[model samples]
Target: MAGTLHFHPNNLFAPCITNLFWFKLHHHVMVQFKKYVESFPVKPLFIVFTVLFFITPSAIASVQISRTQILMGDVPVTLVVKTAKKHTIKVTRAMEETFLLGKKLSDSLSEFSSASDISRINRSPSHVWISLKEPLSLFLLEKSVKASNLTEGAFDITFSSSNKHTSWADLAIDKHHQRVMKKAAGLKLGVSGIAKGLIVELMSHHLTKKGFDRNLVNAGGDVYASGTWIVGIRNPFSPEQKPLTKIKVKNKSVSTSGLYQRGSHIIDPHTHQALGKKEAPLWASVTTIGNEGPMTDALTTGFFLLPFHKIESIVQQNTGFKVILITLKKQVIKISH
Candidate 1:
């Protein structure tokens, strides 16, 4: 029997076949095959057919994630999550809870805040008990102290006389008892270096648990990514200049340190003074990326204190870490694996 074929622009199968005989045969077979197709279970078979029909060897779905911002650690933090479809409700709730938890943790650890729990600890040694959900924040403090020691106290966190001679490691954590102990009287613990990074990490973990496989959490300049993300390192000297370098990273962190944003915040711990404003004509901003956001954050400050040659040597000693230094004269230096 003679049969006719019809093509629809919106239909994916319309463009490939040109032979009228094959097209007529296909049309006739499909027209008569309705009962056979309908015999299969509806939902599951429909899904399978839809998937197979769409897999025409060239069709692709470019799924994009959504981003939201929340205030945490005295700064606006942006969280990005990628899923099959929009999940604003879940994202908003997750972010709200994350920020609340972060704020509570920050309140417990901040040394600068007058009413912080750590401040109360500074006043009296009565065994201040602090609870934190973010373990990386505590870990960062320990690592920062060690980094400070390695740099000969260049990055000391105990600069304040009120919190003198303090070590985060000295503050023992009784996980079984859910309490932290500090022996020294005036010793205070602060998570300034790690708080923002910890917030990003925690938020990423939370989103991943919610089925978000690709996402980025950025707290100011500290950024953490679970999948490929784009990051730009600003040029410290050139206010109008574009980023010194752009990087694509996954499951990693990137941080930049310069005299621009928080000028005197990164003080030389040993000198107890501001890092000299003497700008290096060869490089103004130094950005570093590594396994941990807090480490990248701390190392950026440490690298700013060292000379160009020393920066290369230090980066070489540490594998899997990339560094980009931009000088005042617009020179760019990159060290990466």
Candidate 2:
């Protein structure tokens, strides 16, 4: 196998600073064999075949074939493509496509950008159907609505709205027309909780469609693994920021939400206020692993704001979901179906 790892030196989210590294032990071995055979005189034809047979397999075996690349932005993204070295061209194209898709999704969902789809939707006249340009935006909105329903309003995108009456229920979605209307005034959608995971999902899907079925896409703390991956749960309270534990998952998504990640960014939908202030948060971090990236992301945020029993009940109801809760006291609790 052959592999390349790329990273930006200034990227704070990258694990290492190496810009690019090529691992081609097989190539090195072939070069060494050519020099050895040229310097020796013994049955050249038979010796050449014998050396090639032994070295070819060893060279291929030593080559690290996976391609791992990092993209730095508001949220750091890591894309891993697992394929044979012969498919380098395909892997390059797949990475480019996935990166472009991720950028588009981020731009469309960014509330800070006035020209973004979310911002345009927010500024649109209330109760009037506004046509959507980017189909990705509409897809995210539909998923947002489903997430709100799944979490029983605990993961509402309308939590950012200042209007007391505004909620996810007031948003009317016309999927056939690719339009939406919010009945309540001042209803603004804040989809940061699930947008990253959507980005991960779409990027992973694009790679898989391009024949790279064994891949991993991680945006911030939201991750989607197409094959088996061993992911670690970070210890938020630890000064060294070590992993408290690790778990192996197959074809699943994992997302972690906590005050440690963004410092009280999560809001309680019911109270319409930032969490972890009035009362100490029950858990320091909530890590959720599930079959769907968006849902896992939403659940991580939702579980952080819910009580233990409520979280447990929700997890039990969803067979595909499991959660790892790290308490303020540093205790780890694992819940699963």
Candidate 3:
């Protein structure tokens, strides 16, 4: 069995990187072999085979699985995972565990359009103590409030609900009793901004915990890549499905939000209406990279509504965060910290 580790880094500059990588590998191999083999009479054929084994790709032991299912209304939930060699069973079980975990969160967070625990709470009368009975819903609310506060209501979900006088601060959580209650009658919880990304985030964590390292979880374009992955940002209006650009991610999470594809669902938390100009929005696309699901998703949505300066401020304050905004005027702005 070939047990040597192999490295493959695919990206925009693949040829250049590959050449440099291979050169370094060969140099190291030759130098090490010359040093060690000089003390012994080693066959030239033996050195050749040793070097070949290290250079050859060992994908025979790798496994990649992708499955798309109807989840969270009409949105397609896709999970793609690539595992190390000889770990097919490990990858499969990790998939089952992560998807099941994601489904549980999705079912609970499907309240904006579907009936759920959070939805029932939204439908309840004023001051009703909703029994979440699960930590995920509470987590959603916590993240929602945190994002709303961080963005200064720019990423507000409470307003997106067809209710009135609801703010992130009005919601009260009884951590001791494990329940939540709204102060006003019209408050509703919407999780669209953060839910999908969070699912991918949780799935990523689960995969890591299960000892599966190389994987990619794309919850409707919001991605959490455990290892390296080349992700294409699909053009919204292009029927050809061409990627606007490719991004290479390693142990990172990325999200792209736009007035394309599911643009109808992206709502301005303040106006509680779908984003964009109905025909053309001020900004056509937003791409964000980071590690946290809640932050990446919420920030992408929030940045869509924010001015360029505000977006700049955000990137400056947060380390390891980068954003690219493309406007309707064909201007592209990139911010990183």
Candidate 4:
């Protein structure tokens, strides 16, 4: 991304300060005296000075520059910054590197550490317990499992090729020792859901440290914004659908869960069945905004299973978050901060 800034020196500082310290000091006094003179000024001198001050620096100091792309998360990511071009580029590069490393760490721990990988680790049960090479992924998985339990199993990480029951909670994380153990055989872990958010958070922190005033990190659909950004909540029912509304977001995360994508991927853990039928009016899509991505992910999943009345309570409990639920009938309900 590239941008330009036109700086008018007259708007910022006096024009005659371009030379030596003493000359600049004399220029400041003269400008102050000129301002006082202008208060009772002859019109011609006032007009001439004003035009010189305003136009000169604008022509001299206007800047134009381009920003380079920085790859982040599991893919390449780029964001536009309107201020501090050089610093923004450096920050973006650092964040990109951080996100790439974080993804590598997450992939090593979970993606390659599946049941198939475990089968190759060893053939013995007594020594089956293993310590992950990367512990942050393990921490993210722990948080996901806890969220799953809290949301009454609406958000689950477990899936089986044979269509059987496998719970992530059954796996134990020894945080002190940085190890994990499975209670039963055939239990596997996948960190796909929560890893994106972790990567976004990491990048956001990196950019903030580098003094970029505003930035956004979007991993597929999961997004984190450091400063003000506009979001469009999609309308679920329309064939020619548009975003139901525009929302202002800052330093927050937004996640949208819907039946439109990967139909029935989310199953209610308690019943071990997809959410198909319900007693109350349900939305086709639900978009949730919150301080953390994992929480937003969990809440969006849970909200899909809840009645409209229940959603109010959920929003109330998590006060800082906002929610927009788009029904199958094309109706929109907004819960705002």
Global fold similarity of model 3 (TM-score): 0.76
Q: What would the TM-scores of all predictions be?
A: 0.69, 0.77, 0.76, 0.67
Per-residue lDDT of 1-337 in model 4, one digit per residue for the tens? Answer: 2223332254444344333665567567777876886686486877668778877665544222223333332444444443443354565565566556655544454454443232322232432566655656556767777667655665666543123565756667677877666666656454555555666666666666766647776654566788888877655554257776778998898877766752376555556566664333266888889888767766677677777777786677657878888778767788864
Q: Ranking by TM-score, best first?
A: 2, 3, 1, 4
Judging by TM-score, tell me the better candidate of 2 and 4. 2
Q: Each candidate's lDDT (Cα)? A: 0.63, 0.79, 0.74, 0.62
Model 4 spans > 4 angstroms off:
1-78, 84-106, 109-128, 161-163, 238-241, 262-264, 270-281
The stretch of ten residues in a row with the least summed lDDT in candidate 2 is 10-19
Model 1 lDDT, residue 36, Cα:
65
Residue-by-residue lDDT tens digits, candidate 3, 276-309:
5453455778888987887788888887788888
lDDT of 4 at 34: 66
- Full-model lDDT, candidate 2: 0.79
Worst window of 10 by summed lDDT in candidate 1:
274-283
lDDT of 1 by residue, 194-312 (tens): 55665566667766676666878777778888888888777676646887678989898887766676556665544545655443223367788888766777777767677777777
**Which candidate would rank higher by lDDT, 3 or 4?**
3
| Candidate 1: pairs in clash | 282-327, 283-326, 283-327, 284-326, 284-327
Pick the winner on lDDT between candidates 2 and 3.
Answer: 2
Q: Candidate 4 clashing pairs?
A: none
Highest lDDT scorer: 2
Off by over 4 Å in 1: 1-51, 54-70, 86-88, 112-117, 124-138, 162-190, 238-241, 276-283
For every model shown, the clashing-pair count is 5, 4, 1, 0
